[model samples]
Each structure stands twice: as C-alpha cells, then as structure tokens.
Target chain A: MAPAIKKYGITVSIGLLAFIILVAIFAGQVAPHDPENGKLDDRLFGPCAEYPLGTDQMGRCILSRIIFGARISLSVGIIVVSASVTVGTAIGLISGYFGGLIDEAIMRIVDSFLAFPSTLLALGIAGLFGAGFINMVIALIIVDWTPYARLIRATVIDLRGMEFIKASIGLGMGDLFVILRHVLPNTLSPLLVMATTGLGYVILAAAGLSFLGFGVQPPTPEWGFMLNDGKMFIRTAPYIMIFPGMMIMIVVLAFNYLGDSLRDLLDPRMKMVIR
Target chain B: MITDERPGENRPLVEVYSLKVVFPTDDGIVRAIDTMDLSIREGEKLGLIGESGCGKTVFGHAIMRLLEDTTKVTGNIVFRGKALYSLDRESMRRLRGKEIGMILQNPGASLNPVLTVGSQVSEVLVLHKGLKKRTAWDRVVGLLGRVRIPEPERRAGEYPHQFSGGMKERAVIAMGIASEPVMIIADEPTKGLDVTVKRKIVRLLKEVTVEKTMLIITHDLDVAEEVCDRIAVMYAGELVEIAPRGAMFERQLHPYVQGFFQSLPDRGLKPIPGMSPSLIHLPEGCRFHPRCNRATGRCRTEHPEMIDTGDGRCVRCFLYA
Candidate 1:
C-alpha cells in the first residue's frame, strides 16, 4: 500500500510487468503454433484467421515467436543484473571501506571501463570473445557493473563516517563485520532502485547486440534476432519486425516505470511528495 | 611550583603526555589539541568542560584513537600501563570496546537506523564476550533494564526511530556498557534532552559507573557537578585547569575559568567578552591573554606551563606563578 503504487500509471505498469512475466513463463501454452515451424505456402501472409498478427518471410508465426522471445529477454536481463550487482557491490564495499591505495586502484579501473560508451565496450568485448548468447551476456556484464560499483562506493564512502559505523568498529567488530552489517544494508535502497532501472537497460543492450547479429544465432525465438531477420523485408512484410519490436518496447517500459516508482517509494526524502 | 597530591592513590590508569592533534584542511591547518597533558586514575570520574570546538571531544577521540587516519597525532597515550598509539590495529580494536567504551554526542546518529535495538546491543556482547545469540538476547534485555528503559523486552525489538530522544540515549548507554568496560567516555550524554530527563541520565550514569573510571565531557557545569569527581577545564586546545570538584567550585585559579563560572545564570549571567580564538590562527603566546582582564606584557609574551598547587589542584596562569 505504498503511495507510489496508488498512482494509476504505476499500478498499470506493475500489472503490465506481471502479465509479461506470466506470458514468458507460459509461452508454450499461450502461443497457438510452434515459433520455429514454417510453411512454404504461407510465407509473408498478413493477418489471417490462424496467424493473427501475420507471418514472416519464412512463413513462421510472428505472434508465437514474439511470445517465446520474452523468455530470453527477461532471463538475460535478470541473470546479468544479478551477477553484476553481486560482484560490483563486493568490490565497492572493499574499495570504499579500506579507502587508500586499494580504493585508488579499483576506482581507476572502473573509470577506465566507464570511459568507453557501454554499447561500444560491449560490442568490442562480444566481438573479441566471438558472438553468441553467453559471450553477449559476458560483454553486457563487463559494461554494466561499473555503475553499480560507482554508486555503491559513493554511498559507502558517506556512510563510513556515520557514528554507527564508528561505534561498531569501536565495539571490536572487525572490518568485514562492520562493512557487512553497518555499511551494506544502508546502501540497499539505492542499489535496488538502480538494479530495477538497470534491468531495462540490460535488456535493451542484449537486444541491441542480438539485432547486430552478435546475440542469439539464427532460428532462435529471440526478439532482437527476429528483428534482424525481418529487416530485409520491412517494406514487404513489416509485421515481422513490428510485432517483436513492440514486445521489447513494452517490457522495457514496464521495468522503467517500476524503477521510477520504487525510487519514489524507497527514498525517505520523497515521502512527503509521495504522500 | 607546588605539587598537588591526592591522599593515597598512585599510578594513574590512563596517562596522556603532550598530546597534539592537527588537521590540514583547505582553509588552513587546524591545531585542534596542542600539547595537552592529562591523567585519569582508576575508579575516578573526570569531567572535561570547554566551549564547542575547543578540543574536548577531540581529546576524547585521541584517547580512543578514533580520529581519521589523515589527522596528525603526536605524543603518547598510556592506558592500563600500555602505550595505546604503539599498539597494532588488531590490538587497538580489542582494547576499544573491552577496555574503553564511548557514548557518542548524538545518540540518534550513533545507533544504526536499519538495525533492531536488541541486535545492535547484542552484537557487542557476542563480539567481545563470545555470548551465543540466545544468551545475548537475555543479557541485552537485562542491560536495557539497567538503563531503566521501560518495556525492555518490547523496546529491544524496535528500531532507533521508534524510540524518543531520551530513550535513544538510554539505549546508546546500554550499548556502551554492554562489554563491562573499565572506563566509559560519555560525550554530552544529555545534550538535547529535557532537564528532568537530564537528571535521570546523570543518575543512571552515576549508578552504572560506580567502580569504573569515566570521562564525562559536557559544557553544562551543573551536569558536570552532579557526576564528576574531578573537573578539567579546557580552553582553546589546552587544559587550563584541573582540580577536585569541590575545590574548582570554591576557588577557581585561571581567569578564563573564573569567566566561565561568572557567565552562569546563577552567577550574575555575565557573559564572557570576545569570541573564542580560531584554532587556525591562535594567539602568539598564552592563548587566553587576549581576553584576560589581568593580562600583562609578560602574560602576552610567555606561554605559562601548568603549575601545581597543593591538594590535587593545578592551573596554567602567571598569577599562580
């Protein structure tokens, strides 16, 4: 019953996210045809009774393909973010807590990673490792974790001077205990907000990589890969690109809205405005 | 020079000799504490009184070694016959809570907001005494009762924000004494509480620190008079006077100490003239000469050393010399 959830737009956003997740979870049962099955006679068909949205150049059902693609987009988004946040938070805690040569070294490496545009960095990494699902995920993780590290480090730096942290240390708790107990919990709200928002960006980045042919290889029901296959026939069979593109947009928007609403809900300074 | 002597006690518990703390900042180098010397005997309560920014808290942090690493600290701090500064980080960590406890100035800021009051206190017990969680919980409840926190069982389950200011302070005190430290430093324990609550806090502190040594830092003379056995007056980063509580109130030697007592509402409400000196650019010689009515040419040119008077009294002034 947070005030942010009471807003009409955010409620709808939450519902949309839930619906998308459900569809992704039950993709096989929800779709009428196999996403990979194609008929030569029905190639490039538009808005038939059986093919509601239409068919692609290979006569594959676009609706079925887009529904199954949700699974890939959501899974990649979740896994990559989870791995990065774990690694990034640990690095940030150590760097900020110890705060001397260690801080300088870690921060300089983070800065170097940040210097390159994230997409360009991911592209280079993916290109080097050779293109595929796991390589693309690795590339995305490398490009994504710096923001988490930087944000958490900044928060931990401020919290290290707080009296509670000093009191904990004065009580004979070691550095590890203080950082884990006193420092990490304080950073959680901001980290959560960042993670929720970062999910949308990660999904978009994954799709972008796939669109450029470095993601899920051919015949996979990934939305970005579908968009890549349909681009050549855009003028002739626009529905092939349009339906999958719309699915990506809706999922990303759902995540962005959830992230924004969570920020308003979790930030104590925003309580008055929310109320 | 007269040497002030207490009747029988010898070998002080904590001895600080010529301690200096300096911080280099963007504005200038802040001389926070300058060549200060003090001693606290076992089972004695010493009150440190000074204006804000006059190095009282800094002196306490110096004893605890809690100041930032960037700060420049010089001179020795001997606690329980061990040199505190020369100890390794692990040894210092062990000594901090087990031997010397600290109740910070702001209770609200000193308790973690996200943690339950019980867990925070029990953390100390578990860490220092190796008490199991279940046993620590019962001890935490007992500690809460000792501090006179009402509904000790239920209150322990609540977070800091759920408690009132006075209750928060009591909780902080509970945490401070959890390890049964030999010396407890309570910094402005009753700073923002009401008068009634202040008296209660003082009484609670007095009861808990009966046989233990304590350093109570406060600008309020009444609070100090209520708890301290001996009082040390600090002015502009120096210990201007140290005397028994009764002796200080009956006869103050340093002019600044006299000015301090005079400004009290019970003592004519006369305000001390001139602002406290900025630490960055302190006066050339005796720091108090610029504001002293009894100042002479010699007083301005010479920094007076602490001259001991008989019967456990000392003052830094030319009049005593």
Candidate 2:
C-alpha cells in the first residue's frame, strides 16, 4: 500500500464510521419517509427526486429503509460487543490469574466454543432459540464473547508474571484489586483493537442471520431483512438488493479498516511513523 | 538504633529452619535453594551477597512466602514467633505490607506504569491500614517526601512514566515503608544503578530503615559493608560464610568468601577458578568445592554443615569443620 492510500484509508474509514453512527442515531429525523409504510402505486420504481434510490418490492423508499436499517445494525453491534467484552474479560481474568485446574477447565470450554466456525455456531444457536430480534442478539453475543475470553485470557496469562503484578500482590492488595488495577489496564489497547474488528464481525453476522430469516422480523427494515425482502425481485428490480447490499458491505469494510488503523496506532510492536 | 535495653532486640525477628525450594521442570528438579537456615535479628541490618543466579532472589522470595505453588517448599519460616508457612491465606496477605514489606529489584518494573505514583503508594495504606483515599493521598505525599522525592505534592499526581529511574526507586521504597512494617526486605535495591544513584539510594535506605530490621540482598561488597551490620555470603544455593561486616571483610574463613572478595575490582581483581556448579546437578559434596582453590579430599566427598566459628559467625566448609 502506498503511503498516501494508507493515510487516506484511515481518514475515510473514520469518516464513514462516524457518518454511519450519526445516521443510526438520527434515523427518526433523517429518513424522509416512513420505512415501513409503502405505496403500492409506485412499487418497484427506480431513482426519483421525491423518493431517492427508488422504491422496493413494498414500494417503500429504499433510501429511507437503508437509513433505518443502520439503527438496528449499529445498536446490535454495540450492545453485543459490549456485553461479550465484559463477560469475557471477567472470565478470562479469573481463569488466567488462578492457573492449574481452573485454568484448564475454562480454557477447554473456550476451545470448544472456538472449535466450530463462529457463524455456523451462531446460526445453530439462533435456530435453536427460534428467529426474533432479541433471540438473535442473544445468539450473537454467546458466540461473540468466546473470542474476547480467549484474547483476555492470553493477555492476562502474559501479565500474570509481570514484575509489577507480583509487586502489587506483595503489597497486600487482594487478587481482585490487582486484576483491576494492573492487569485490566494493560490489556485495554489490544482489547480496543480486537473490539473494533469484533464489532464489524458482529454487524455482518447479525445481517447474515436477518437475511436467513433468523433475525428481525419483516416491516422492521433491517439491512439484512431488506435484502431478504428484495431477493425475490432481484431480476425485475436489481436496485432493491443492490442498495441494502452496498450499505452492509460499506459499513463492515469501514469498521475493518478503522480497526486496522487503530492497531497500527496502538500496537507497541509497530514502528510509529509520527505525522 | 541497636538498643540493648529493648527486650527482644537480640532475638530473631525472622527465622528460617531447614528451608528448601525445588522447581520441577521438564529437564529436572531444579534445587533452587538447598536446605538452609537463617535468622534476622530485630533492628538489625543483614546483607545477603552472592553472584547472579546463586538463588539470592529465590531465597528472598521464599522468606516472604511468595514462591509459586508449583514449587515444592518444605520448611518453617517464623515471623514474630509466628510460623509463617502455617498461616492461612488471609493472615499471610495481612502480614505482607503491614508486618513485613518487600522492596523488589528493578524499581522501574516494580511499579505499575499505568497507575500514578501516589495512587500506587497510597494503595498500601488503603489496603493494610484501611485508610480512606483522601487521607491516604495526603500520607502518600508525605511518604514520598520521606523517601527524598522533591515536590511530593505535585509529583504524586503524575504517572510513573514521568519519574526518572532514581525517582521510581524512591517511590517504590515509599510504598514499601508506607505502613511502617516491622521488617523490610530490600532485594538488590542498588543493582543496575550508577555510583551516584547507588550512594544516594544507600543513604536513603539507611535513613528510612533507621530503627527497622532490614534484609538487603546485593552482590556489591561495598554496599553490604556500608549498610549492613552482618553480611551473609551465598554460593550455589547455600550459605558459605556469615559474620559481622568487619570480621567477614577482615578475616573471612570460607575459601569461597575470600575468593569472592579477591575477585572484586578494587581488590586483586582475580576471578575464582571454575564456574559455580549448576543447581540441577550440583557438585557431590560442597557446592563451591569445584571453584575452591584450597579444596581437599574431605571437601569433595562429604557435604559440610554450617559450623560455629565464635563471635556470632558460621562457615559451611570442611576447613572450618
């Protein structure tokens, strides 16, 4: 990659992610039309001045639905990531701090979760719980937390032998205090980088489940469900699938790029080229 | 500081009896600290000197009961007439930082980089004394000043990265003495420091530990002579000779101790013959027999125990036996 592209990629990724967040937060006002209420008279229409990006199979404004879909994707991504990170970090700290049988048991369980392809596991879980927004979010969180657990566990294990930690323990601080003050803060930078990429994966996974009819029910206008709604009409009106598909792809790519740039900025191993 | 009037001044503040530390590795069982006995008198400064990897640090850790659970430790450590090994987990935790403080080597690594120096020092007060944060912060500033740090009030708020090497060491020392523990174990506090810094630290150590019992572990003979009343020499996981600072320096008994002093830069600058024996497979009789210039057949086949050489001195060599 050229230096110019590398710099611009970071800028563009930040800009796009910021825009998506703003769009999600203000979906109620930014959207020109009600995403759920459709007009049969203008069904399958292509780009127009009043209803930009044309109409979908329901004759709903594709642009407005895409804007609304941003809300679900972003919220699900944020909620699931936060929940998983919290749960996983806690488990990982405990497992790594007290090694031996406890460490063995926890790591084996984490390994089992990691053995199956994450998406497939999410699919199986979502299928078991039955399709709905909450159930799908639950499924995503269950699969999502395993990676964070493993990441934190590895970091905690590395920090367990650090001189500072041993010193703190010798200072008579309880195990909990040492983990909170010494171990957790050191794990933050890598955790932040991992979370950014994890957010992108979560958003993509949620969309895939929605597209497969295991996520949010219809009339909700989620990007994945919108894609599902437009799939049957792909031949007659390609714009229906193209618009939402583009939205999902762009958002995921932005998050991934942002994560890459963050790693470069935060990673100690990277030779920082200050600009 | 050595008040003969005090009832327990002559009694041992900390005592170890037949202590051994063994680490079972894939290669073999590494006998880090062989069967050893030690005593630290109340209000006395004892310096333990040895070459690198001679189990000086391990012995320090063992005395504090800070060794890993995987290592096989079979011995008795008595602190204040209480058996340390028999203490429950909570009691042991309470004993640390309150009754006994430890100043680890590498002051830079001993402090948590993410935490402010003040907060790190204040944590000891909070945990052991149960002081509130506000009061603890005030005391932390005072403690920092006590350790010779300038502008303690302002510097206390700054993170560890802002402090220099000597300043970080002072902060670590402040943390160790925050609760005014009865005994403090300082492991090579002067190691890795330049002459000027080492002098300042040695002075600070003497000043802060005026009336407190201290165990200073170091390889610097000058440091031991300067700060310690009694000096113990360790060679290959065992004590070779222990005597008063003046006596040990003037008329040391063990060949290893004499060779050690001769190897110093200012002394004859002669290196001891042969390397220290490997701990995993130490020499059959005396651990230092291979490196001893005056070794005999008796020193080769039989391990010698510590022998009393009068005037509160002991030497673990067949010549003394």
i-RMS for every candidate: 0.9, 0.8
Estimate the TM-score of every prediction: 0.97, 0.97
RMSD of 2: 2.4
B128-216: candidate 2 lDDT, tens digit per residue: 88999999998999999999899999999999999989999899999989989999999999877889999999999999999899999
Instruction: Identify the leading candidate in terms of lDDT.
Output: 1
Evaluated on CA atoms against the true complex, candidate 2 attains a DockQ of: 0.80
Q: Which residue runs of candidate 1 sit more than 4 Å off their true CA positions?
A: A1-6, B1-7
lDDT of 1 by residue, B1-321 (tens): 233436687547888878899999998999999988888888989999999999999988888888888899999899998899999989999998899998888888899999999999999999888999999999999999999999899999999999998999999999999999999999999898899998999999999989999999999999899999999999999999999999999989999999999999998789888989999999977899989999999988899999887678899998988
Native-referenced DockQ of model 1: 0.81
Tens digits of per-residue lDDT for model 1, A163-274: 8898888777889899988999999999999999999999999999999988888788899999898999999989889988998898888888888888888988887876
